[model samples]
Target: MGFRNFRFQIVVRVLLLVATVFVFFKIGFNATLVSTQIFVGLLISGQTVALIVFMERTTNRLIKFLNTIKYDDFTEVFTSRGEGEKFDELYKSYNEVIKKFKDIRSEKEATTHYFQAVVQHIGIGILTFKKSGEVQLMNNAAKCLLQVPRLEQIEHLRAVSPQLVEQLLTLPAGQSAVLKLPHGKERVPVSLYAVDLVLRGEDFRLVSIQNIQRELEDKEMEAWQNLIRVLTHEIMNSVTPIASLAGSVAADVQDYLEAQPGTQICLEREETEDMGLALQTIEKRSQGLVRFVNDFRSLARVPTPKKQLFSVEEMLKQLQLLFQEEVAHENILFIVNCRPASLTVLADRELLEQVLINLVRNAIHALADQPNKTLQLEAFQDEDSRTVLQVSDNGTGISEEAQEQIFLPFYTTKPTGSGIGLSLSKQIMRLHKGSLSVSSELSKGTTFTLRF
Candidate 1:
């Protein structure tokens, strides 16, 4: 490879020696010996010149072939580079590398396109953002949810809510979060889920907002209807008899006084006893109303969160421990399948303890007389979002119609059900910025999904 200048010099010297030898022989200076030396030198010079010319052409062709490959002009084959057997081997190696790079480039573009389209079309809002808080892409759902304009679609969402922005940045790179927006005169109660993404060398996030006001309203209405139905039944049962007995007592006293006006008892001793029992009945109904009010007071004031992190699995386990005996009495089995050996939440320990206990206990009661009375309690990180802890059960599922009403105080499905259990549980979940929902079928089972 370094022989160019040196080889050229040798060729020039050989040619000069041949010409000098020819002149010496013509001038009769050892003419025969010099002529022989001139002939040998001329042959060597011709051979050396031919070799140098070939080498120069070959190396030039190699440089041209390399340039074409570097530019990815794979259309033109490296005929010059691969002509000779030795050079052909080198050409094959170069060709392989070029082909690989081309393949990778094609695949990379395809993947990028696929990712863009797929991410954009998903129902959940997807946003691609830079690590420095610049938005790269906001999908249709995200734009609509955040009220992003067409012109401002790709623009940095600096005008968004600061709480949302703060949550986006503060949550772990791969974690998710839920941001709440209360209902205003113009705005609806919105629940936004912020999910983070780390791809290639970039960071992005998805903020999925779902309108939950309607769902809550539905659940609330259900609870109210159920409560009213049960309460009306209870109150009427008490009030109707009280009114009848009071009327009868008054009539009896009037009759006795009218019949035997002076020095005679207004009513017989049995009548007096009957009147006393009727008054006691009225007091019992009044007491029932008072008890209902007290339960309501407790339901309204959920425990304030001592929002420290604690294991959700541990919570369920403890509930199992507390209610294991009850489950055994009903031949009910408790199953717990949860993630993180320690699935924890930032909530008040005592409050969450009671909430879980109530839900689990209610679940046991729900499966009261079913053929297969089994309760499965599982706490898992949400499939798409890791920050949420979802607790679900497989018991006697609530019907679509009844599922709506299960949360009202005193709204129980049991024959002697008091109905306040689910209402209190829902309030606790709300205190922790969580939710409880029931999805049930006729006879199969009920699944109460608590998301926190």
Candidate 2:
């Protein structure tokens, strides 16, 4: 409608201008009406200029409105200029479209804020990063979990745990994995879940990290308790009777031998000797089996820790002294280091000592065949202000396969090992609200860390 009106105005101006020009030319040769002809010509030029200006004004307004929409500038208000009813309607339409755009933009902003709040307050750590490893978003939970104030790139996470950075980058969407991450002195097990995302045509990965250390410990402890209960019950029921019968048989055989001389019974000396030796063997084997069952019983019977603050320096010194003779006999170099000499840990000193002793003994055994044996006991505070005790050996390292099962009851690579030491030590650490972990490399050695 506006365009039609504009075209009609243009046609009227052209016709009026053409008529004035014709009038001016008809009187152009008459000297008596020269001034009148000049006035008519001037009127024709003014009409021509007005027509061009009118066309440009409408066209310029239309272009400006389009540009406003294109740049998302909803603040541009189209006002009526009193040109005509058609222009008034056009201006009103433009205002309504701008208002709608403003409403839509406001709604989008509110939605964004709502999601941002949820992401920030959620307990699970969330991290969103682009394909190039640039971190787009890291929620407060993620920052707290990683102990980083701010993370601009995923590579920065390598300082916390290199394995974690690798896992985050390579984890496939829709897949999940659980890994042990070293946080402070503690090894926290975290579960990772990844999702592929595309925002505005840019590829991204959304990974969620949740600490599952407590959950894992609970499940593991429950499994060990159940297994130990069943095994102890069944073994005790069978072994107790066998052990008692063996003792009774041995006593009966001795009495019978003493009474044989008075009852006129005679036997070959070799046969009598064989009978006595067999009875002794049965008694010894039965007793050993009973002791073995009792050892397994202890795994399920760990007591609650009676925690107290104790100096780490004194503790390491005591451990070193206790093993001084053995290390000397083995020609091993024993090193003890305690930073600050004043760091202390709140734990059951007795139980903590038991764990350290077990680790130290294992390290010693590992160094049995190494030409250059070294055993190190280190105590210090970790970056997160947690106390850490480490026992390391530079000797024959544990195999990768054995490292996985070293903390499981009855899982040992040593031929004569009772296999309860590592498992039992781990249980004690749990009672202290701490962790026991191991790291080893082939031919490099092993380190058992007790984190409190």
> Which pairs clash inside model 2?
none
The per-residue C-alpha lDDT of model 2 at residue 386 equals 89
lDDT for each candidate structure: 0.69, 0.87
Query: Candidate 1 on 1-452: residue-level lDDT in tens?
Result: 32334455456666666666666456564655876666666766776676577668767767866776678665555443323445666667666766777787789989999988987787656665666766677777666666665423333343656666676566665445555543333555555556677789676665555666677799889767866787787668657877887788788778888888798575568877887987887788778778777776777677677889877777777777888888788887778777778677778889777777777777776777687777887777777654444334455667777777678677677876656778888888888888887777776776777777
Q: Candidate 2, overall lDDT?
A: 0.87
Shift in Å, residue 400, candidate 1 = 16
Model 2 — which ten-residue stretch has the worst lDDT? Answer: 1-10
Task: Give the residue spans of candidate 2 off by over 4 A.
Answer: 1-266
TM values, all candidates: 0.52, 0.52
